[model samples]
Target: MAPLMNRSFTTANTPGIVHIADSAAKRINSINAKAASNPPQAFRITVDSGGCHGYQYVMGLTKEINPAEDVVFEKDGAKVVVDKVSLDLCTGSTLEFVEELIGSSFQVVGNPKAETSCGCKISFNVN
Candidate 1:
């Protein structure tokens, strides 16, 4: 589980919105197009505890979803899912696909609830 979000930081977002960058949506579409699953797949983001920072982001491609616990954000026929708890902690964030010298990956950027995040970008701390 991720560290609890500071309640004070949770109210800055517009509910039911999760921004997907053009690069992220394109990447999601590419991944889903190659998926063999009958239902295709969605990129899942789950925040968990234990990192240099108070919380870390765990992401993967998933074919399963728990409706009650998951929130789906879609763009350009691509899907990104996050649990309700994580949504509360990062509602105003943008999902971005970054290409770097090391590799390319999905990252959460512009999180209004994050006080500070690690240089690696996978871990964050909320004030």
Candidate 2:
């Protein structure tokens, strides 16, 4: 069978998988292209406390990957690596590039396990 390549698919077909938006994949690919580093950096997602909603989501670019501690998901040549700990809270969500009036940024939306979230989008309380 041919492999899935340079494509995006819906979550309905893959339970427990965090979907990546095309905008996000493009953004990551653009960033990595500029960096031009080996082992190519991947977008990293982490969850931590200290925010209006008690917990918060953090995203950044990283070249280091601890296989034992992280899970990497890729789409359209872009990669997203999440710590196992955070994945439990954000599974079934979508990683997206959001452009708004205030500013544009990457965010996680439609988190099935999140009970509540702040207007800023980064702050949240997991269910």
Candidate 3:
């Protein structure tokens, strides 16, 4: 078995940082409004080893805060949080919300460190 290879990100100096696109912010704000309680929350993003590629992204909404573990990004009253480990793979990436005929969702775009990405756009590989 191979050890888990933890490749250091170039943006290590500024870890847990992510960029939010305008469309994403708008969508997040709308979602927050629809929440009946504990609204105006943050999107917490996580990455783990999975998918046909080496990594996958996960996200959820949260009202809780843990200063030691999360880095936050904000725009137009919307907030996003990326934990240290996930940020290593996500730093300098743009978070966008897209609406397609199939459905709509938030996605990571412009990941400079990814060598190749799956057709689904949810998985990626790095050198």
Candidate 4:
């Protein structure tokens, strides 16, 4: 009998640490391009507790630097920085944008730390 071998997958050449939809990326890029005068110092993504599911996603453009923040991924002029506390909860996650009839929003997909998420898709529960 032959022994089974495990196969591992890696993301080495992936374009961005946070994946943006084509439409979303185009919009963000357009906005970023116009910021040449005073471009964003950095983009920050954080996880907080408050949502019905016990966790919420927060994102913003930051000018102040936090020495303790952990940089998870950056690509295509888009950078994603997560705090040490959130890093453990966001490892191996991909950021995505979704446009629907109701609205458009940025969401985290394939989060290994998430055990379940709300129907609205705005929050998650960590395992």
Give me the candidate number with maximum lDDT. Answer: 2
What local distance difference test score does each model get? Answer: 0.78, 0.81, 0.77, 0.61
Ranking of all candidate structures by their TM-score, best first: 2, 3, 1, 4
Candidate 1: residue 89 lDDT (0-100)? 81
Model 4, 55-104: lDDT tens digits are 97787766565654554344444545666677667667766667789987
Tens digit of per-residue lDDT, candidate 1, span 64-84: 988777877777667788888
Tally clashing residue pairs in candidate 3.
0
Q: Give candidate 1's error at residue 68 in angstroms.
A: 0.9
Question: Which residue pairs show collisions in model 3?
Answer: none
Backbone collision tally, model 2: 0
* Candidate 2 per-residue C-alpha lDDT over 9-101 given as tens digits, one digit per residue, 9 for 90 to 100: 322222345788999999999888888877678999898887998878989999898876777788977888887788877888999999889
Worst 10 residues of 4 by lDDT: 1-10
Q: After superposition, how far is residue 87 of candidate 1 from its true place, in Å?
A: 0.8
Clashes of 4: 0
* TM-score per model over all chains: 0.83, 0.86, 0.84, 0.71
Q: Candidate 2: list runs displaced more than 4 Å.
A: 1-15
State which candidate, 1 or 2, has the greater lDDT: 2
| Clashes within 3 Å, all models in order | 0, 0, 0, 0
Highest-TM-score candidate: 2
lDDT of 3 at 95: 90
